[model samples]
Target: MMRGLPAFFAVLLAALLVSPTSARAEGPLVLAAASLQDVMVALADDWAARGCERPVLSFAGTQAIARQAAAGAPADIFISADRQWMDYLQKGDHLQADSRHILARNRLVIVAGEDGAWLGDPAAFLNAVEGRPLAVADTESVPAGRYAKAALTKMGVWNRVEGDLARTENVRAALALVERGAAPYGIVYQTDARASKAVRIAGRFAPRAHAPIVYPAALLKTASHEDAAPFLDFLTSPRAQAIFRRYGFAPAANDR
Candidate 1:
């Protein structure tokens, strides 16, 4: 009798382990820009608890993501940090015109290591520091780099400071240079500066320094998931917008 009771409970426990409710749970779908990692992960957790599948995030540069999608990666969506990359995919016929949408906006900020001195003015940013190197993204491919270059050029300091520039592959990498003290100052998005405690904002460049920064999200033409529609809807939902705003992203103009 004792053996039979133990056997019965074991069978019941096995049945509970394989319950149909547990079997029906699904994982999330995601392909996101590296800069969006912190907020996106939180958003995904909130979504998963609401019966949405947990998102599988793939983080990389927006340009890299666009190229991967164009090359036939099995991504359900692409969240680009800029429109140019998304437009690149669209121009290549890799994304459906109707699937594209501008997601958010960001502001550029000049940041220095926590121990570094403040840059009192934008003009001072152009001069060479005896020991500190200036870091920037590579203007050829990274949107942030290109924007920074344009802004510096507008300020008429590009040529003067170009010699001191330490070009990085991406914005995050540029930020890293400053954070690690490899470079004394870096141009990065405000949100990125906020992400690291090792960095401090020395000053904000005038808005006229560069064109407005915008981030775009889209469903690729080759996305395989039918559930992508719901996922995209969640992204633009108020909850997601709130998350972005909390992370320092501006409300997209098209949100109206």
Candidate 2:
């Protein structure tokens, strides 16, 4: 009886191996920036619906993921919220040079909960939040935060509000602080404001408010050419660009 059980298990395993569904399986682990949550998830799901295996998505600050890639983490792809982190990985020889692509662009915005004050010009905006904690992504390490700081500095309000800043690990968390009314104001990506029902756009920073918000993607060195190539191709594809657009992202001008 024991011998029969072993033979049966071996046959089942062989059948499973040859199954058409398993034969085409590809599992690529993707590490991305936090602000990409809504759009990236939708893109991955769309890819899965088209028959390829869903790529595993890991979202966090670009700095953290850059550190992971530098540490030789098991990642097949990296999509950064800013180019600096991508440049960091490329310098470390952790990315496939030819596969690098600028996928999207975004702008910054100030958001407030339903009852929060409407934002106007920079000086008035600062006045509106005076003595109240203003939420933002951590400027030292987070791309969104750095951009927020740059925008504030550009508008000449950074020095005034610096003391009232409530920095969070990522933009999404900062958005949350506003959503739950913990903060009266939060600076985040325009796309983030679009995604949340709990918040509304109080104002948008000008194009020159800070450096351009760019999202760049690349296959990691540890990713197999066979495993990572398709997803990389799909990212800049018209279909994928459409998904990004639906989520409020501006397609990278050089996307073609």
Candidate 3:
């Protein structure tokens, strides 16, 4: 049995602010990157309206979710903020290879807490944080963190700031740290900066700073529900893609 749009949104909208692990995630499941939370909710809503059974959406760090899928967490669809995680799943035979597609794209940016300032120059901005910690995801596994580290390492500032990081489980948690003024700044997706009223854009990283940022989506081989296919198709449809663009996301090919 499928849930309806209004009911699902009512539950999911509230969970958007809650911790991902604690989220009441039920599914033919869709494990998504934390940064995609807002638009995925909209896409889910639209899917429900179209008479598709609602997907149970579990949001987490790309690595975290990928590990879950690799360890055999039950999911029908997986959307990763970076292609590497998707590849990780494919290598493990966790995905339905034919269903894989690049769904959207985004770029990285530096952000300040509501009380923090955007100084506009990369070197100067890094200097301003001084000895204070900057919020970031886990660089080794989290794509946002990896991109952040890449950008900083390229600028020759990683040596100075590496020990000063306040790492979070995911990008959104890093956003929360900055939003609440607990961290002086954070490296996050431009779209994440747009989603929060508590944070403001300080500067953007050049596309050359890191590997291309892509949101690759795919179906898992273990899904039990028929609803997963319709929801997956809705993701790249004009209607869903428009919702993505409205939130500052680009089509995946834009990065190329």
Candidate 4:
């Protein structure tokens, strides 16, 4: 009877292993990025509904993503808000050399919470908010934070208010600090600010304040998916571009 039981269990295991649905369960295409969270989540859900495998995403500062991918994380794609970090990974031989492409552009804006003090003029804006905590991503790792610091410095206010700056891990974290009233103001991408109704945009920094904001996406060399090429094609499709536009990202220019 014990011998018969072993044979029955083996048959059951074989049946389960051979089941088409069980064998064909699709795994996710893992994506790493910070700014692409909202749009990517929506797109992934839509793609899933259309029979495409839903993508799993990990959002953080671009530097963090670069380090993880460089350390051999199982990331299928890496989308960075800046080219420098992507270049860093590429130079380290962590990315598929040919798969890189600029995917989108963004704008920088200063946002004040609904309950916060008003920022009238650019100069008065700095003065009125003196001594108050202002959130920004870590300048060392986040492009948005670096741009914010550059803009403030260009306006001759960065040094004056340097002590009031509250650094967060990423653009999203900076936005959260503002949204939750932990900080009265925050500097984040226009799209990041637009994603939250809790904050009102004080103003957009002039474009001359910093380099243009651009986003680049690429498939990593270590990606496990066989459909990586098709996925890249899907990312550049008009449908995906429209999704980016709806989320406040500008179309990638010819040079991007």
Best by lDDT: 2
Question: Across residues 41-117, which tens digit of lDDT does each residue of candidate 4 receive?
Answer: 77666666777765655677887777767766666788888888888888999887678877789998888888665
Q: TM-score: which candidate is best? A: 2
> Which pairs of residues have clashing backbones in candidate 3?
none
Clashing pairs in 1: 28-54, 28-55
What is candidate 4's CA lDDT for residue 215? 84
Q: Is candidate 1 or candidate 4 better by lDDT?
A: 4
Which candidate model has the greater lDDT, 1 or 3? 3
lDDT of each: 0.74, 0.84, 0.82, 0.77
lDDT of 1 by residue, 4-90 (tens): 666556433442333244344344345667678778877777888887676667666666666667766656778888777877887
- Judged by lDDT against the true structure, how good is candidate 1? 0.74
Q: Show where candidate 4 strays beyond 4 Å.
A: 1-28, 117-120
What TM-scores do the predictions have? Answer: 0.84, 0.88, 0.87, 0.85
Which digits, one per residue and each the tens of the lDDT, describe model 2 over residues 149-234?
A: 99899988888889999999889999999999999899999999999999999988997978889999999887853657788789
Question: Model 1 residue 188 lDDT?
Answer: 88
**Residue 114 of candidate 2: its Cα lDDT?**
83
Reference-based TM-score, model 3: 0.87
Q: After superposition, how far is residue 250 of candidate 4 from its true place, in Å?
A: 1.0
